[model samples]
Target: MPKPNPANLFHDLPDKLAAELVNILVETPSIRIERIVSTGQCSDAGFWYDQEESEWVIVLKGRAQLCFADGTPPKTLCPGDHVTIPAHQKHRIDWTSASEPTVWLAVFFSA
Candidate 1:
């Protein structure tokens, strides 16, 4: 067996921001892990994410707001906050802190 690869989650952050940067840290048949860096990014109006896989996401740095299509109050996520979104749930990023890059760790898995 080979030695397991080691990495720091906060390493290699992007300096310029044209779009959200997504890096896949791990992928297998049943699960995928990604690191997302967002600097003042949000979903377009009337748009939502309808994913086939369930997702568990955590904010590693900065802050964000997640809104659902059901009219519930948007969930505010600060650093160290996390939420699990069920498959097919209509959700979108409403806002993110612009002064600093918001770092997120997202894990997607089969339901």
Candidate 2:
């Protein structure tokens, strides 16, 4: 016997501002599969993720702004933009827009 593999899926948002989660992998104990997110009017605020893990993220479409807690100016990102949030690094989504949908692929894992 063997496990079945599902086909690729696509998700569309209803409003001009929305987030569609394409997929999520959960194997546990090691690196997870991946998370595909589509967003509009998203923002990174004054909090943080991955307190016990690290995150690798990339922009697949549209644009966004990444705000850091170190007083650094927000960084603009578009298609093909990538960033890694280190463990315990506080950050947020500075801004996003509805004109264009922002797509992101994120990988999270602990070390």
Candidate 3:
């Protein structure tokens, strides 16, 4: 088979978002990789994300704030910042930079 073409994570950002963009870059039975682009979007108040799989996420560009429902302090992420969230941990994106599109690389896997 021919070699697969590679992609740049920082290029070709989506325009005119009705919501945050979530693009699955790779997937398997046990793992999934995603590229997420956010333009000043935040989760709704009193809402939280509870995922079955563990997640490791990194900020590739711009900035964002993440908060957990368990009273943990919110985290501010800039370029190159990363965090690991365990399964069933309630969390949400509190804020994303309005000045530019925030790019995130997230990996989800079964533990």
Candidate 4:
């Protein structure tokens, strides 16, 4: 398997993105880390991510919004912002910055 992730998270991004890009940075039996780049991407209508693993995510650049199934207002995240979603908690991406790519670091692990 290829061993290297990019040396920099902000490098090699295309000027226009047709969809969000996700790259696995690390993976083990119980944990996975990902680098996600979103350019004006949102979850498909009525789609929610309901994963069995807990997720802790941080916004490394740009901005985005997360919507939960509990009907609370979407939470906006900018650089330096972070949140943890417990296992099985339904959520979806509501918005992302269109003018720039939003970089996110996500760690998922079995709880």
lDDT of 4 by residue, 11-109 (tens): 787556899899999999999999999999999999999999999999998999999998877899999999999998899999999998899999999
Best of the two (2, 3) by lDDT: 3
Could you tell me every candidate's TM-score relative to the true structure? 0.90, 0.69, 0.91, 0.91
Better of 1 and 2 by lDDT: 1
By lDDT, the candidates rank as 3, 4, 1, 2
Question: Which digits, one per residue and each the tens of the lDDT, describe model 2 over residues 1-111?
Answer: 955445322245333534445466555776765645545655434454435778788887767887777676777888788887787776777666467566677777884
Which residue pairs clash within candidate 4?
none
What's the lDDT of the predicted structure labeled candidate 4?
0.92
All candidates' lDDT scores?
Answer: 0.92, 0.65, 0.93, 0.92
Give stretches of model 3 more than 4 Å off: 1-6
| Residues 1-111, model 3: lDDT tens digits | 965444878777865477999999999999999999999999999899999999999999989999999999999999999999999999999999988999999999997
What's model 1's lDDT at 84?
A: 94
lDDT of 1 by residue, 1-111 (tens): 965444877776765588999999999999999999999999999899999999999999989999998777799999999999999888999998898889999999998
Highest lDDT, which number? 3
lDDT of 4 at 101: 89
> What TM-score does prediction 4 earn?
0.91
